[model samples]
Target: MITQRQILGTGAAVLAATLTVAGCSDSGEQSGGDAGGSASIVVSTFPFGVEEFTQAVLDPFTEATGIEVEIDTGSNADRLSQLSLADGSNGVDVMLISDTYAGMGEEEGLFQPVTAADVPTMDEIAPFAVSEQYSGPAYSYQLNGTMYNTDELTAEEAASWDLYANADYAGRLALPDISVTAGQLMVSGVAASVGSGPYDVDAAFATLGEWAPNILQFYSSTTEMTNLLTQGEIVAGDALNGFATELVAAGEPIAWTAPAQGRYMATNRAMIPVGAENVEGATKFIDFLLGVEAQQASAEIVGDLPVNLGIEFPQEIIDVVGDIAQDPTGAGYETLDPREIVPNRDVWVERFAREVVGG
Candidate 1:
């Protein structure tokens, strides 16, 4: 098993420095020189886990296809803002972004539509991963679930959404704030459990409001929630499955479970921006990312849950998610529609603060 320190410390700083320097190149220009007459494409990606991602996906891709890759990394909002400001001249050939931001970009016409004709691997990934809602396909996904201290709770006890409101655990549980990714999932989960469906914010907020006093905190960051769990300040919290995996691997007595009633997931997609200089190379890179080998490596190294149906997850992942990694949809996980999310995001955030967290 990979230790937390090893996963967090390895080559990340150097990779960040390299990306910072590379990202300074002018808009509409490829940051790296062409390699052996092969196309050079700039890939905009998340800032964290740079080293693992490069090793798992980028370097091997360059080795195989001779397509030089230049990386640009930042938070989703910041990077998407940059791409928008650049108009069609962002010079980013491929964008690895969360589904929400991808949907926003698609609505703004910042990305070009991609199909199986452009990336054959699209046919092999999960159907939800290639939804017509976005121009690109999901390369990876995340499940929202409850994380609990095994010493304090059983898997059966933690699997219910009612755990948050249980008087026995009052003032010893946490829930994500409505601003983060996990927050949205929790809201949708609660909505699905107590109301009509995932988008039933009225039912979700009312239920959460009633349970607010029981919650130790409405945590805004993963670090805060994880620290609370580790210090035994809180026994359990609603969090992304990734947050619990490392802690569980480190023998922290942490365990995560998909809630018995409502389950939702978020995805990260591989998108091609409009005016991408190397469209063919972009398609090729995305194809490689969705391929079985690349998906497996990403799951093992970068800890992303693969979207490719053919991927046989590594033992480390199995140790964490068990059989859910095999078939997420069959296991009762569903992705929330981005169209339902993007437009109402602000209103929901405000209401969540006023009614659920604050009330």
Candidate 2:
């Protein structure tokens, strides 16, 4: 129920507290020497955009706090698996991963709890960013929606789930494969639309199975979906909103629209491993990442929707999502509970392949 105005208004005091703890100062001297003074941490993050991320977040943090940051990058699943296999000796101090993977790590005891006491900035982010189900907090989020060829469909048509099943668009539409993030969101959206709620698999599969014949491809990667859309091979697909940002900006005849019903979002979290070598450094890094300046830089460079409510988004971000970023929950977007998702993930993926895509 928090409005954008309220969130923005509350940020001034929060940012002041965050700056004190983060060791940032106008004199370019490390104010909080405990986390500075030659402390170091290894940060595991998504492989893409390393340069941009380092410039926007890591470099600034090191400059402000004198914490040495070593970069480690991989896919979410790969990094999580490594952490599990290492049994707390992964040497990873902090991990920036998706919420789903963070939940899995929490269940496996690979990560330790990160409370607001450890990261004061946690109190400033949107409520959803503070996880009740994981060991970390969400730093940024992605919304699931429809990305379509603007020349082929009206915005109204793209905003409805029915577009996937329309006979007129058969053989020219793509849907994310169940193995991917968008695929799971699409399933839940269908479930909510046709059955009792987001977890109603029976209703979701039944509806998706019927629509299968109309879909040209079950895409598993961003490249596949973007290529299909760019070449005019597919008219539309269910995808995360970020997928359409670049294409739309380049003057491609493409657009993204949030579905009229059953909207869902996914988050990227900042988690500390169970045996992190430098917990204090990790905590400081997380606090800095959640601060207003870092959040705004990330939104502009990484194309992520900032969880820091105080951030005034860049024009590029606004053009892609409009005011939805201001208050996702108010706009009807929901994030799936990882507790429910973790236990049933394998079964859901198997069934989706067999009953939905296999049909």
- RMSD (CA, Å), each prediction: 5.0, 9.9
Task: Identify the leading candidate in terms of TM-score.
Answer: 1
Top-lDDT structure, candidate number: 1
* Inter-residue clash pairs, candidate 1: none
Residues 33-152, model 1: lDDT tens digits: 332233577788877788899899899998888776777777777778878888845667788899888878877889988899979999999887988899899999999999999999
Give the per-residue lDDT of model 2 (tens digit) for 54-82: 88898889889877676656677777887
Work out the TM-score per prediction: 0.91, 0.89
Backbone clashes for every candidate come to: 0, 0
The C-alpha stretches of model 2 lying farther than 4 A from their native spots are: 1-38
